[model samples]
Each structure stands twice: as C-alpha cells, then as structure tokens.
Target: MKKEKQYINIFIIFLFILVSLLMIIPLVRNGRINAYSDWTFHSARVQQIYLNLQRGNLLTFIATDVSQHTGVGTFLFYPYLFLYPWAIFKLVVSPVTAFYLWYASITLLTLIISYYSMMRFSKENYVQSLIFAFVYMLVPYRLYLGQVVLGEFIAATFLPLVFLGLYEILWGDLKKWYLLSIGMSLLVYSHILSVYLSCQVIALIFAGYLILSKISIKRIKVLLYSAILTIFLSLPVVVLFITDFIGKGIATTFTGIAIEPEFNSVIVDSFRNWNGFNIGLILMVTFIIGGVIVRKNKQLKYIYVLGVLLTIAATSVVPWYMFSNTILGKVQLTNRYFSFGDLFLAVIASYGLSRLFDKKLDIVRKSILMFLISIGSVFIFYASSTWVLQETHTYNKELYLLLQPKKKNGVPKIPDRVQLDNNNYNYQFEYRSLTGSSDYYPIKAYDNQSKVDSILNQETYINGKRRKLIGRYNTNTIKYRISLKSKSRVDLPVIKYNHTEVYVNNNLIKNSRISDRGTIDLTLDKGMNNINIKYQPNFSFYTCVIISAIIWLLLFIYIVKVW
Candidate 1:
C-alpha cells in the first residue's frame, strides 16, 4: 500500500508538470515566452547585479528617470523578490542564466499556485486541479503581460502559499503562523500594488470571519502574529519606501488625474471575443447558479456572493457605474489592473464544479456539459495561442526593422539646446539639423521620452510626480536656432565635449571633460544663456567595485542569518 501511494504521488507530480507544459508551449513558440518590455529593464538590472556579482558586488540596482527631484524612481525597487531564486541560481551559473532560471521557475510556480490553492481551498483531486490550473494560466491578463517581465509574476507566486498558510492557521495543525507571515511579507516586497490589493481581499475575509464567529484568544493570536511577522519580513520594501517617501508623495499628485482609454468599437469587440466561445467560464457560472439553487455550504455563501460581485466588477460588466468609476477606474481599468478577481472566479468555479460533478449527474447531462466545456477549451486555447504568436512575430519584425544598419547620407551637427516636454505617449523620436552631419553619434538622451517608454510594458504605481515627454519625436535641423528659457539654475547638459562650444553671456568657456552631465555653479543673472552640449560615446566604464563589495558583504551576512 505504501509503495502504491508513493507511485501515485509521483504520477500526480508528473501530471502537474504536463499541465504546466501545455500552458507554456504557446508562449515558448511565440519567441516571447520569457518576460518582455519593462521586464527587459528589470532583466537588465538583474544583469547589472550579475555584473556586480562577477566583480563580487551586492548592492541593489538604482534607476533615474523623469522625476529627478528626490530620486523618484528609487522607491519602486524590490530586492527580495529578485534575490530569493537569484542567490540559488548564482551558485553554479552566470547571472543571465540565473535570471532566466528564475523567470522559468516563476512561470512554473504560477501553475503550482493554482494546484495548491485548489487542494487547500477545495476538495478537488489532481485532475480537477490540473484543469483549473490550465484555465488560470490562460487568464487574459497573465497572457497579455507574459512578455513584460516584472516583479508581479514573482510576487504572484505567493498568493497560493498565502492562502494555504491562512488555511493552516484557521484549521490545520500549524501552531505558529510564522510561515504564513513570511509568505505575506514576501508579497509585500514583490510588488506593492499586488500586495495592496491582496491585503484588501484578505481584510474582507477577516471581516467576514469576524461577523460569523465569536473571537477567540487563538484566533487573535494567529492574526497578531501573522501581521507582526509580515511587517518584519517586509522591512526591505519598507526601507526602500522610506528612502523615497517624499518623492512618492509628489508622484501621487501627478498621477492623481484619471484618464479613460477610448478604443474603437471594433477593437472593443475583437478584445471581448474569445476563440471557441470559452464555455468553461460559462459552465462555471452555470454551476455557481446551480450551487445557489441547491444551497450547498451556507457558511461559504459570502464567498460565492462576493466572488460573483468581484467577477462582475473585474469585467466592468457591473450595472453600478458609480461604483465602477470611483473604485475600479481609479485603480486603472477593471481587467488590466486586478486579476486577483481570477481567484474569486476560481473559488466560485470550484464550489460550482464540486456540486455539478457530485453523485446526482445522469449520463446525458454530464456528457453534454463535458462536450461544451471541451469545445470552449479548444476555442480559448486556439484564440489565445494564435494571438500570442502574432504579437511575438510582430514585435520581432519591428525589432529587426529598428536594428537594421543604415548608411549615413549626410553630416551630423550638434544641437545648441534641447527642449523637452514634461503628456507624450510614443517614444519614437527624430533629431534633425540641416547643419548637422549624417554621421551617427550615439548619446544616451536623458528625458521624459525614455521614462514613459520604460514603464509602458508594465503596470507600476510610481510614488512621485513626473514630467511627460514633450513630443513623440525630437527634431533638429540646420536652418533653425535652438533656444531655451532659463530657470533659477542652469544645468548644462554634459556631453563628450567633442566639437561643442558653450557661451555664457557671450563668453566662451574653454574647459572640457569626459563627464556627460555638467553642472553650472555660476549664478545666472536672470535671462538667457547659450548652452551647447555635443557628445560622442567614449565608452567610459563605471567602476562600482567598492560599492559592489560592500553590498555583497551585507547580502552574504543577511543570507547566512536567514538560512
């Protein structure tokens, strides 16, 4: 019997792995199975960290962007999510290898999360878990952001773990809720927005529990321990927040205005239409209604009702426009911003399925529902998989087009002054000057243009106010004069000091340096000063060996203590 049980366990694991592979195949075929977009930046930052590791460095990567005041971008960094798997991968491989390793692992974890949550929250067998996991993997939001590598994916892994931990605290033998606390803390550090939404969900759960049951010392102890432990575990994210707390305040004001996206009706229809009319969700809905009719588990009525409400809210199909506008729109659109509704959907589906598949189903009824479910599955798989493939191919074509080298047809001239706008969307820009040479000069432009592009691929709630890109493109031409109105301080754009000349009040400064950002310490009288910044990449290597070493040392100590 023991041997048989072991074999069954192995078989179940294999089945789960197979289900995960089914979900991954489409993403892999699209050439964008890995995280793309803002993920590229995070990946690059991970690469930078690896570079530091190669040189024995440990400090987290820092970024600069449109909001220069008070280091606005630094607050968003979360090191723990990136480091957990990174440290393990670092043992035997290069940094890039480790980064991909983590990416792949997280993808696998998403499936595992579904399986584990189903097991803990429902009485489903392995097969049901596999089916549920498959459906969850195809969730539109997950697929949409699959290419955008960000902390959200990693952070999402903890959802099931948190649910399971909570289950243990409520009904299992786990006396200490420390493990759940750790998972909750990890969520906080993974992505604050995800954590914030998740916490609200859990808060609702606690509120429901409070209404239903008399408070016990054990329950209060569990709650207090979980909260305290979570806070302690989330210290890394807290510290980073404190570092830029002031900047976040400013960012909040800037992003406060809510803008609604207006797409054409055709686009809207195309988005709503799923490939084979995924009836799995529809069947699940039917089952939910059926459960209501049968009145199964009255204790869970709150979950069923709340889940249904959240599903409507998530899809923006709810009749209450005021509630949707004030709450959902303020958070960003319903579907895009919160996929946690998928959790509630899963709960309703699980409950409904348990009822539908119970002993009472006659042959004809079971067969018919199964057939419809299969058809829906096939339709959804084909539609979503095809879209993923097309998106990948189109992105590849665009990247290839952008990368093709072109022969210079004219001489390139340096711009006298650059004026950048602080609400532009597109990042594609052009620099033209009739006097400018056609010769290509690579200078990394630091403006709002790059910042917006950086965050486009991911959903991020920046903690500070920021400027917008002035235009889609920056054009410089030979016939036009570059002009600027000076503020209290004139910050000279640092360049390679090649052929560019600077004149303050008609007096030419005769000094040059390798610095790309030069500061003008001299007080400006009140009006206009001619500023020219000409740059050519001299490929200066930024050495951070000392900083890296100190960071690595601290990280090492932290790891040793934690482990």
Candidate 2:
C-alpha cells in the first residue's frame, strides 16, 4: 500500500512535468528559441564550457576563444559548476539541441526539487505538494526565465529548497539545516547578483519571523551553521570574486540596475512583457483569496503579509528614481524581487486550496484547472507582447535578429570580428562575445572609446620597442615564432589576472611578468623563439574545490544517516 502510494505520487508528478513541457514543444520543433533577453550570453557560456571540457579543461574560468580569442574571465564570477553536465552533454548533441536539452533538464530538476521541498513542508500532503511544485515552476515570470535563460533563472530554480530550509530552521525541523546550505550553495553557483537579491529577501523573512516568535538559541545555531557551510561550499567562487574585486581595480560591471523601473507591474500587467517583471493576475487573486480563507496557521499569515511587502518591492512602491544611484538601486533590476516573492504567494495559494477543498479529488481538480489557466494566460500574453514589441520597438526586433545568429558548420557563428571591431559597439555583445565585455577586465582599460579602440586595434600583439613576432595560437596557450633584431622586453596585448602563467621555451616567467595594463610582459631573446602562454586557476581554487567536495560529502552522509 505504501509503495503504491509512492508510485502514484511519482506518476502524478511526471504527468505535471509532461504538461508543463508541452509549452516548449513548438519552440523546439521550429528551432525558434525565445530570443527575449540574456539567452545569447548563456549560449556563449555553454559553448565555452563545452569547448574547455573537450580539451579536458574541467574548470573553465576563462573563455579563451570567445570574443575573437581575446579571452574573457566570465567563469571567474559567474556560478557555472551546474553547467558542467550540460557542457558534457554537448559531446554527442548539436549546440542547439544541447542548449534545449540543458533547459529541459533545468525544468525537470526544478519540478522535482520543488516537489520535495513542499513535500517536506506539507508533511506528505501529496496533492498540495505537487500543486506547490507545479505553481512555483509555472509562475509567469519564471516562464520568462524559461525563455531567456538568465543566470538568475538558474539561481531561482533552487529557491523552494531555500524556502524549505528556512522553514525548517524557523518553524519546522531544525535537523534539515543541510537543505538550506545546499540550496544557497547552488544559488551562489548560479548567479552572484541573485545571491545579493535573495539575501535581501532572507533578511526580510528573518526580521518578520523575529517579531512573531522568540529566537531560540538552537535555531540560531542552525542558521549560523547553515551560513558557515554555504560560505565554505562557495569558497571557490566567493574567493575568486573577493580577490578580483578587491585586489584588482575591476570597476563595477553592471550599468542597468534601475533602467526598467516603469516595466515593474503588480496584479494587472499593462504589457505582456514576460521577463519576470510582473505580478500575474492568478497570484494576486490567489493571495487575496487565500489570506481570507485560511486563517489557521500564524506562519501562513506571516507569509501572507510578507507576500504583500514583496509585491510592493517588486512593483517599485518605493520611488526608484530617488534611489537610482544609492545602494537600493544595486538590486541589478527592481523587477527581480518577483523571482522569490511569487514563491510565498504560491505556497499560500496551494495550501489554502488544499485546506479549503475537504476532499482529495477537489484539491487535485482545482490545482489542474488553475495550472491550465496559467499556461494559457502566459502563452497569450507572451505572443501578444512579442507582436506589440515588434511593431512598437524597433530595437528589440534588431536585437531579436542579432541574438538568434545563423549557424555555420553545425554551430552558431559570431559575426566577423573586423567588421564589429571597426563599425560599432553593442551592449548585447557583452553577453554573447568573449572580448570587450569590460565585465571583469581592469576598469581603466575599457574606460573610454579611445582606450577600447587601442586595445582592439593593437595590430602587433608584441609591444616591445624593437622586437616583433607573429604566429598562430589556440585556447589556453599561444605559440609564436619570432625573429628579433635584439633581445628586448615586450608586452603582449593579452589581459592577465588571477593565476595566469607565461612560458618562453619551456621556462616559467613568474613575478614581474604582468604589465600595468594587465598585459603579458616578457623579455624575448635575439633569435627565432617559441613562446607559450597558459592560464590555470591555481592553488586556491583547487583547494576550495577539494575542501567543498569533502564538506558536501559529509553533509550528504549526515542527511542520509538521519533520514
């Protein structure tokens, strides 16, 4: 009987997954990806990871061949260890297929993860648990994440686990602290800005909980332990960010924090912008009705109220223009609050429905109907908005075309480098290309057009007074055959930071090799010489990976033992 119940649960969960996946079928069949936002950037990242993995470069911190082979340190700050499996999947599949497969995998994992999270919270209320997972995954904004596929989307995938862990720490079982750690660790691995955004929401929840109940020392300990464990697990990426941001003169990479404040919406969306920038009608009605119908659980009440605060934040209730340059503006985008806000509302809505409908049949029936409604609404909104955007916004149409590049030799090809280098600069290229992103590069290097132009037009890579060399090179290493008039010290236009290495005829050139411009500086001997340049994020990153692996191993063992 127990086994039968478990089997039924699995079947239903899969049924929901299949239904959700149906939405993307047309997209996959037509090869028309939702070229909405940030997909190009993620596409480049997956490609780079795949290339590096093929070369046996498992830890690909820098994309050597992207952006016309100038290289970019995208992986140093972006949380991408989760992308490794998809990167590996590229072994047998085409780039486009792998991209879709990876997205499908995200959808699969998110459904299961969310199911487990709510299962624990609802105490085996299978109908409520499945609905919670279903609603959370299909939240309108999350559907946007599904299309454009931002790093924040990846981070958002694990939010239920984070909520579950928080629930355990505050009101539920404290023994499940590991769930919070794992969730946060994955978030850190997914997107750092998301971590920043999520931390703010967490602070709100913590404060709200404090007002309702006294903080027990035991729960406090669990919270602290979970935090510490997250820090340790995220040491590799966190340490990389810290060292680069603090030690190096890398200026802030983001410029569009509060750029789209007007796009923020609540309850009724005036525009069908499906990019996680709105509060859907279903959620608003669900929360309002749920708040009135379910009055039993105080925690639910707090969550109900918390959802209001999040809505305010999501809708920009606070005047954004005044805080444009202030710390509040650093949210990367104001609409991002909806990423987690909808979670609370979904929980309340599902739990309320479960409680209100006395029979299991009614709960299942309502949940399915609501799910279908959401899907239909999202499709109409997305299709209508896209048509409106094409008619009203010419820039988006151009961007839509630019982002969905044509394939060359079974893979997408970046446009000609010379043409792009000479003609114009597009911000969208920052996500798609390897070079000139100015993200982690030293600030002053690309501070102005002249400087950027100089970097791009530096014809001779060797920058010595009298020495000149030229040859071909591949990812990670550059091989150059040079005939020098005299032995002269030279700088290569290549940018170097964080465990970059230079070798001349198999000799390591350490200390005093990097120039002020973050270029590779080396002395060339008078003769035909071969030079090799390599980058392997050394000791510190290696140690963090090892230590974090061990800690996670122990954590899983503990979870298994306790279970």
Candidate 3:
C-alpha cells in the first residue's frame, strides 16, 4: 500500500508538470497574441484595467481612454473581476508576456477545478477526474474562446465548481453551499453572458431534476441557500448590469437587434474547421458511446440527455431563428450553448472511459489509450487555432510595439499615451469596443463616434468662447483648472452619465446640466476653479460592493475551515 501511494503521488506530480509545461505550445509557436476578431478589444481592456489599477482606481467603471478619448462605459455593463487578475499581471510584465502567463494560469485553474469536480462526481476516481479536466479544457469551443481572448470561456474555469456545488447540494454533502456561491459569483465577475447562459442551463437541470425525483423541502432549501448567497456575493456586478441596462443610459451594439447565425454543418463542426466552434469529434463520439454504455447511473443518464439537447440547440436542430426577437435570441450566438454542452458531455465521457482506462487495465492498453487521447487533444487545439490565430489581420502586429530584435539596444519604453481605434463592428463578427461588440456607448456619443477626432480636437466651449482647454485624465477621473473673470458657464469635453458627478474645488454640484455634446455643463465661479469630472455610481453600487465583499470574505473563511 505504501509503494502504491508513492507511485500515485509521483504520477500526480507528473500530471501537474505536464499540464503546466504544455501551456507553452502557443507562446513558443507564436510569440504574441494575434489581433483576431476580439484581440484588439480584449488587449485594450487589459491595458485600460492596468492603467486604472496603476492610478489606484480600485473600482473601475468608466474608461477614460478609448474612442479618441471619448472613453467607453463597458465596465458598467460587463463584469471585470476575472480581468483583474490579467490586468495585475500587466502591471509587472510586458503585454505579450503578460497575456501568455494569464493564459497558462487560466488553464491551470480550469484543470484543477475541473479535476476536483469530476472526482466528486466519479466518487473519487482519479482517472475519471483527469479525463474530465482534459475534456473540459481541451474542447474546441472553450479553447476557441481563449484563442480570441473572449471572456465568457474564462468564466468556464469555475463551471466545474458550479457543477460540484449542485451535486453536493442535491445529492451529496449538503454543507458545502459556498462552492456554488463561489462558482456563480466568479462567473458573474468574469462574464455577464456566461451568468445568463448558466442560469438558463441551471433552470433546465432543475426542471429535469424536479421531474425525475420526488420534490423535497430540504433539497429546495439547500438550492435556494446556494442561490441567495451567490446573488449577494455577485450583487456588485448584478446591480451594475441592472442599473446600466434598465436605465437605458447607453446604446449597445446588439441592444435591440436580434441576430441568428446560419448554422455550420454538424459534420464539419465535429471534425475540424476554419469555421466557428462546436463540440468536436472526440466529445461527440464519447458522448454517444458513453451515454449508451454507462446506463446504470441515472445521474449520468441525465448528463447524457442534457448534452444531447444542448448540442441540438447549438446546431440547426432547434429552430433558433423563430425566436430571434425573443429573449432567447438575446443570447446572440447559438454556439454559446455548446459551452454547457461540452461540460455535461465531458462528465459523461469521463465516466464511460473510467472503467476502460482503469489502473487495473493492461499497461499496453492504458498506454495506447492515453496516447490516442493526447494526440486527439493536440489535434483539437490545432484545429481550433486554424482560423483565428493563423489568419488574424493583426497577427504580425505586436500588442503595442514590435519587439526590438536581439542585440539591439535602446528598446522602446512604454508610451505615456496609448491610442485605441474604434475598430467598430461591421457585422462580420469583428468588433473592438473592447468587447465582441461596441456595447454600452451613450447614444449621443455613438452617433458622434465618427467625429471623435473633431470632438476631441475642437476647442472647448467656455463662456460661449472657444478655448483649447483639456483636463488631466486618469482612467476614471479628469481634472481641469480653469481661471475666469466673473461667473461663467463652461462646457468640458468630459462625457456625463446620469451617475457622473461634477465637483468644483471639492464642492459637489448637484443639479448639474449636460452640454449640447452630451457632456457635463458647469457654471464656474470667478478666479481659479478646480473641476473634477468622474463617474460616481449611486448608493446601491457601494452597498452592493460592500455586501459582495463581506459575502466573499465569509466564503473564503468557510473554504479554509471546511475544505
């Protein structure tokens, strides 16, 4: 028994090393992230977050940089929690190196979390756990999200924890409610759309669970507890999402527009393609075979069914277009369903393969099976990269400036001012409002986006006179010193939201008016008046942040105490 345990420990070490080292394939193959459909957008986001953090803006909401310095309110509508980690990395490293390190960190996290969740599901089957980690991480869809640097898939790292929390609540140990909260909260922090997608899938699972099993009061309470705790923990982001969206403070690219993409053939998606992603061949085959063979476990059966149903939803089998204008179409992309599909199917496949890939199996057979899986995973990664990384328009362009060749001296220092182009959406899956689309631009600002140069370059309006006066801008706050004779009305270039506040010499000016350009309008006192224009979210925002922080801290303590 001692000898066996030693071998297992060694193998686990090997697994960790293998996974960590393998993350270098992309970095080694391509030194920098290619500006694919969303690369410019995400890279810009990272840069903005880095700047904000550098300037000590802990709660960054309004960006004061993009779109010719008109800035964007993306932080209002999007959850920026996961990006914080990447942004922190940017503070210490070059963007190129920072991105690569962030990628590896996310992958390692996914592996560890997915493995633990699968171990719970498979009743501590190490082999099954390993397979679950690989299958979840290696799927074409998830990796494709990463290749483009889209954030929804980053939230996927916590999905296994979400699944485990559900499992523990409904079927296993009931004391681990914090796991669900942690998972859902992280999802909200990472991506709003993932939270939306997750909620729908969770509802379906509950519906199915309620149908098959007897309704129990205990079960409902556990589930509700997990949910309420998650809500409180994620309230900071949730409130922002609600406030911005409900207030109609801005126009988003897909705000009122509903689009249904034409489906790629299932066969093409299952194999390999330059087309967008779906569940690939290995997953498809595994799901079918595993679902049929692993019949004894009812839980596994439900997993199988959910996977199949979601796969259909992602493809043409479901009449997605019919509901184009409905709330369902609000999801925008049908393939997003496949993230959940991949999750459930990975579980089923891991289970089915577990018995065959057991340690008791012949050494040669086990070796061969592992070899095949290893090769197939590599193939999936390559196939996913075929389009985005390989053919990106800015593939040859570095994140900021090209690296100085080896032996060259006086490499460029970081720029004092970084300019981000609109790179606006043209409806071909290309966009860079720092999102997949130009989300949450004030309506007036978006209309004037074309004239951003003129807007910024034009003289500032002061007492009906043109003055070339601009404020000193950090990421969130812009300050200006304006000297005047007598009282005068001034129009600063700063854009104003309902939540935006104006203060003169540290005195709050309530009932501030907006200029014709949709920016803040100010009445100034004579002599030098200090003007501060910045976004200050309402009381509810701070309340949510405080509550969310408390909940998260409690959850963290519980984690240390319990697990």
Candidate 4:
C-alpha cells in the first residue's frame, strides 16, 4: 500500500506539471513568444531588479529607470517580492525565458501546494485533491488574471497554504500557528491588494468558525499569536509601504466607475466575458454539493460560507462603493474577490468529491457519475483553452508588433538634454536613450526638458561665483571635471531620493540638497572638481531588511523541526 501510494503521488505530480505546460500552450504554440497586456510593464520591472542586483545593490528600493527622466521609487512603493524569482532566473537565463520560467514555475507550485493543502483537509483523499488542484489552476478567472495581472496570479499561489494554516490555527494543533504567519507574510510580499482582500476573507472565515465551533481560550490565544507573528514578520514591508503612501499618497485612486447598484447587464458581462468571475457550471455544482455533504464539518462549513459571501461580493449588486471610495480603494478593483471565491469553491468541490467516493454506491451508478464528471471536466478545459487562445491572438496581433526590438543603425548621438517623450510606457524612452545612444545621460531624468537642459548645458553659479563644465561623464558614478573659477553650487542631473549621496573629490559632501527640479545640488570647490553622484541604501532600510531576513530564517527552522 505504501509503494502504491508513492506511485500515485508521483503520477499526481506528473499530471500537475503536464497541466501547467498545457496552460502555456498558446504561448509556445507556432514557435512564437506572445505578450500579455501587462507583460511589458512586468518585464521592465524584472529587468530593473536584475540589473540593480547585478550592480551590487542588494536591497533595491529606488528604480532609476522609470517615470521618463525623473526616476520613481518602485520597490519603495510597490510590492516587488513576486519579481525576485524572475530576477534570480535571469541570472542564469535570458530575460524572456526567465519570465516564462517564472510563470510556469508559479503555476506548478500553485498546483502542488493546492493538492497538499487539500489532502491535509480531506484526510489524504488523493483523487479528490488532484481534482481540486486541477480545477483551481484552470479556473477561468485565474487564467485571465495570469495573462493580465501577474501580481494577483502570484498571490493566488499562496492562498491555499494560507487557508491550510488558518485551519490548523483555528481548529487543529495550536502549535501550527506558524503556518498562518508564513502564508500571510508571503501574501503581503506578493501584492498589497491581494493582502487586503485576503485579510477580509480570512476574517469572514474566522467569524464563521466562531459561530459554528465552541470558542476556547487556546484557540483565541493561538489566533492572536498567529496574527502577531504575521504582522511582526511583515513589519518591514508594512513600514516601507506606509512610508511611501504617506509620501506619495496611494498608488491609485477610486473614480466611482467600478461601483454597480443592480445585478444586471454589467454583472452578466463580467461572468460571460471572461473578466475573472466565471465559476463555470461544473465547479458551481460541485461546490453546492460539497457544502450540503460537509454541512456538519465546522471548518469546511465556514469555507463554504466564505465562498458564498465572496461570490456575492464579486458581483455588481454589492455596495462596492463603500470599499472602493474609502482607503481600501488602493486595491483598485472589486472583481479580485472572485480569485478568493474560486479558491474556496475549489476546496469545497474537492470535499464533495471525497464524500461522494466515501458513500456505498453501486458500481453502475458510480461509473455513470464518473462519466458525467469526466465530460464536465473536458468541457471546462475546452472553454478555458479557447479563451486563452483568443486572448493570446488578440495580444499578439495588437501589441506584440509594437514591442519588437528596433535595431540601432548607427551610433546614435545623445541630445543636449534627455528628451522626455510621451512614450513613457515600458520605460521606452529610457531604454532608447540609454542603450541606443553613445552619450551618457540619466535614463529617467526629470521631465521638464527646459529645466534639465538649463541645468546640464552651460555653467552654474552660486553666490555670484561662476563654474565652468570642463568635462562631464558617467560610469558607475556620475563624474564631472568642473573648472570652478570660484567656489560655487552646481547642480547635477541626478534625482534626489532618501538613498542618494554625493561626494566632492573623495570626501562625502555633508550638505547636499535637491534642486527645485529634483536634481542633486552640490557646492563645488574652486579649481578642477571631481564630483561623483550615486545611490546607496540608508542604514534604516538595511536594518529592516536584515531583521526581516533573520525572522524568516528562524521561522523556516521552526517549520522544518516542528511541522
């Protein structure tokens, strides 16, 4: 029996890999590389992280190649942990291949983790676990999310493990509370929006469980410990995120367009148009059946109820305005609720399958039921494939052509000033000016061309003293040979950030300030001055990261020894 079980587990893993590969068929088919809507955006981010890592900057908070001329703080504001795997892969492979590998690897991981989590809850019902994993992976909403929203796709990969941890903490072994911390930390790092949505769902599940099961002191203590650990482990990220928010406001704003008061055409369109809410007939039936069969199981019952609530919230009838217009609007869209809904429904469907198998049924009846279920599975697969292919074709035909690499015919000359063009998407302006030109200029310089040109061209003066730009250049350091006739303040085309540092000759400049146009303003000494401008992480950021790393290591050790 042990040997047979081992073989079955091997086969299940093989199936997962096969299914993951099949989902990428559209990308691999016809020997072509396809681009999704957000592929360029994500690819640019990955390239930035990889290049920064290669440059010996281990902790990347400031991205110097976005926002046209003036760089933006990417990692400082956005959740970039999801892109780390791609950056690591890029160390060994091409950027494009690394992206494909990242996507495929996440898909496979999601399936494997989903299966194990389901098995834990279902008492090792292998067949049902496999089915749930398959359904969850191929859910239309999840597929659509992968094509357009990489962050959400990455966050969904950890949802199962989160529920697994929550289940153990709330009802099972109290010592397993660490699982919740691990899962929540990963989710928080993956996407802020997903974290917000996940917290709401977890809260609903906890509430439902409280209503169903007798409340015990141990459970409450375990729950509080798990929450505290999760928050503690996530402190660095949370602090960074809040700091960015306070400095730059939320990354997005609510426009009141996504709210709908009635469940009518718009709601129908979201389901019918493959907009990340389509549950499909098969999973819906299984979910309902599972809820009925497992009505007595407290944990499963809460999950089922959570699924129903999420499903309703995903629709247009819900008062999304309250959430969307408030601080929660940073999440951007209410449709993201469907991702969590699909997760719970998939688990419920698996429970239903396990229950169906546990009952004593005649062979003929079992055979008939199996046949119908198999047919339903095929239908879902066909529908999902069709949608993926259509999306791929549309993306390839419309956007892929624009993204083809343009060859530099000759050594391109750099303009006197970095041209802040309208083509800011994918950092196209930066890429062209930096990589396709011979001269050195800030790739993402300040957008005000006139101001930048004034700063870069001609001489700068301070306190009625003039300084001449004898020689200006850049390598790892922005170098300048300034013939300062008299001691004067001169401005350099480097964006000012918390991490920016300037040095005169070899000594650190103690009083460098940002200019009105966001460049570094430095006071230069008389005679030829060698100025170097660079970005270095502050001690506080490093301390936060180091502390988080230590906690992560300790958590890993605890999980390995105890779990």
* lDDT scores of the candidates, listed in order: 0.43, 0.65, 0.68, 0.62
Over the stretch 374-466, how does candidate 1's per-residue lDDT look in tens digits? 345445755755754554443433232121122233112112322111111001112122111111111222224243222221111111222
Predicted structure 3: lDDT? 0.68
- RMSD of model 2 against the true structure: 5.7
- TM-score, structure 3 vs. true: 0.81
**Per-residue alpha-carbon lDDT of candidate 3 for residues 236-323, written as tens digits (9 for 90 to 100):** 8788767756765566656322333344566566666333466776677865586676689877788888888887777666777677
Where does model 4 exceed 4 Å of error? 30-37, 53-58, 65-69, 91-94, 210-212, 235-277, 284-299, 354-382, 385-387, 390-398, 401-495, 504-507, 515-531
Tell me how far the alpha carbon of residue 341 in candidate 1 is from the true structure, in angstroms, after superposition.
2.1
Clashes of each: 29, 3, 0, 3
Across 178-220, the per-residue lDDT of candidate 4 in tens digits comes to 8788888889888766877888878877777778778888888
Give the top-scoring candidate (TM-score): 2
Please, what is the TM-score per model?
A: 0.58, 0.83, 0.81, 0.75
469 Cα displacement, candidate 4 (Å): 13
RMSD of each: 12.7, 5.7, 6.6, 7.5
Where is model 3 more than 4 Å wrong at Cα? Answer: 1-14, 25-29, 239-245, 252-264, 273-275, 287-290, 359-438, 443-470, 481-493, 505-507, 515-518, 523-530, 538-544
Scanning candidate 4 in windows of ten residues, the lowest lDDT window is 413-422
What TM-score would candidate 2 get against the native? 0.83
lDDT of 2 by residue, 1-563 (tens): 58656665667665656654664454344443434345655666676777777777666766565543444577776677778766777788655455556776787788788878888988877767766776677676776676555677788789999888988998898778788888888999998778777788888888877877897988988899999999998888877876655767665555445444353344456233343556565566765576784577876787777776676666656677676677677875677777777888888877865665445455446456545644553465445335423332332333243333433222233332211110122323333333225566666665664444433333234543423334354556555666777887776656677667777877887774655555666778988767776666667777888998898889888888997
Better of 1 and 4 by lDDT: 4
Cα deviation at 33, candidate 2, in Å, is 2.7
Q: lDDT rank, highest first?
A: 3, 2, 4, 1
On lDDT, the candidate that comes out on top is 3
